[model samples]
Target: MIELQGVHKAFGPKRVLNGIDLTVPTGESMVIIGGSGTGKSVLIKCILGLIRHDAGQILLDGEDVTKAERDAFLARFGMLFQGGALFDSLTVWQNVAFRLLRGSLKRPKDEAREIAIEKLRRVGLKPDVADLFPAELSGGMQKRVGLARAIAAEPEIIFFDEPTTGLDPIMSGVINDLIREIVVEMGATAMTITHDMTSVRAIADKVAMLHDGVIQWTGPVSQLDESGDPYLDQFIHGRAEGPIEAVR
Candidate 1:
């Protein structure tokens, strides 16, 4: 449903993305695994049109959406940012219903609140929690609220950045399971970027590794261990001494 062809991006003197080619089919979950400063986040920003690529085509549903009709195109996606990115001033319900309250996709307040509560429930949050502020919730709860917001509109496509970062293993598992469940329930095309191996195993249908601003490997999740690519091996196994450079 989404495709990037020959994408390239640069920031002044530094070129972060070089010839990126990727595709996420409808209803499939693709996870990007890479080390810090490998341009993984840049790749995702390009997809969202937050960071325009210097050259290349971004096609959504067989149409070029790089500069034209971007608004209409972007509304199709829901994103859970790396840090949850919630509005501190807004209550939990308002945060989840932000898109629904003001946008071309806007819904009435009563309806929006109902949808927000339902979405919260979908992510295992009780309705009572919707009245609480973000600061009142734990990190995991905040992440769950972010998840609820992302799917509140039942978007056709979703982007999850570092979905399992900064959480304990058990909490990470809960969030991962919620992500997997919602993605499947919505049948939405999903893309996640994360370094956690547990997240990869839980959320990815396909895996792509980014190294040196290029895709080092792309394959099914089940084939990751047997890909015979040293880069994939080094990453998934967390091997310190390999082709992927790491300094002690």
Candidate 2:
């Protein structure tokens, strides 16, 4: 569903993504694992056209993303940000229904709220919680609300940016299971960027390791531990030493 070919990006003297060739198949989950500053987020931004790449191509369904019509192109995607990124002023239901309340996907107020409530339920939240503000919810609850919002618009593609950030192990596990289940249930093409090995293991159908501004290794999740790339080995096992030098 998505493909990147010889992609390159940089900020003045610093290069981020270089020759990042990868693909995410339709209705499957691809998790990108990398050390901090490896440009995983930048690659996603480049694909979304949030940041223009210096060279090469990002294709969504065989068409170049840079040339696609902005509105219709973006409408096909949903994103769960690294931070919960909820509007503190808006109530949970309103936040979930943000897309449905405006732009091309707008719906009647009543219908939007109903869909919001249903999505909240799907993410394991009760109906009463919908009226509360984001501040009233716990971290995990906030994340669940974000997930509900991501799926509320029924996007064909979903991008999860560190889905389990800032949660306890149990809550992280819950979010991982929810992400895996929801992606499969909705059959949405999924691309996630996270350093968390546990999240990678739980949510990925395929794993790609990003290092030194390129895809160092990519293959089925089932073959992760046996892939035998030093960069990937050091990353997935959390080693302090390898090709990746830990900053002191």
Candidate 3:
């Protein structure tokens, strides 16, 4: 459902992405794994048009995203940001229903709240929790709230940025399972960028390792362990040395 061809992006003197070529098929979950500063998030932003690429093309469902209508094009996707990014001023339900309460997808307040509650339940949150604010929740709860919000609009595509970051092992496992379940249940195409290997194992149908600003390896998750690529092997095993240099 998404494709990037010869994509390149640079900021001033630094080159972040260099000719990235990758694809995510319809209803498939593709997880991108990479070292720090390898531009995983930048790749997603490029596709979303948040950071315009300097060259090449990004196509969504066969049409170039750069030429598409901004609002209408964006409505087809959802994002769960790295930090949860819930509104501090809004209640949990309000945060989840934010998109539904405004713009082309707007619904009546009561309707939006009901949908939010249902989404919360799907993410293993109780309706009672919906009335609480973000500050009152635990990290896991906040992540769930973010997940609920991402799926609230029933988007055809979803982007998960470091979904398991900053959570304990058990909580990370919960979030991984939740992400996998929701993506499959919704039958949506998913692209996730995360350094968490466990999250990649649990959530990805296919895995792509980004290095040196380009894809070094792309294959099914099952093949990751046996792929025999130095860069990928170093990353998945957390090796201190290989083709990838560990920063001191």
- Per-candidate TM equals 0.97, 0.98, 0.99
Give the per-residue lDDT of model 1 (tens digit) for 14-42: 98988888888999999999998889989
Count of steric clashes across candidates, in order: 0, 0, 0
Residue 198, model 2, lDDT:
92
- What is the C-alpha RMSD, rounded to one decimal, of candidate 1? 1.0
TM-score of 1: 0.97
Which ranking of candidates, highest TM-score first?
Answer: 3, 2, 1
Q: What are the RMSD figures for all models against the true structure?
A: 1.0, 0.8, 0.7
Show where candidate 1 strays beyond 4 Å.
none
Local accuracy by lDDT, each model = 0.91, 0.95, 0.96
By lDDT, the best candidate is 3
Which candidate, 1 or 2, has the higher TM-score? Answer: 2
Q: lDDT per residue, candidate 3, 52-115, as tens digits?
A: 9999999998999999999999999999999899999999999999999999999999999999
Candidate 3 yields a Cα-based lDDT of 0.96
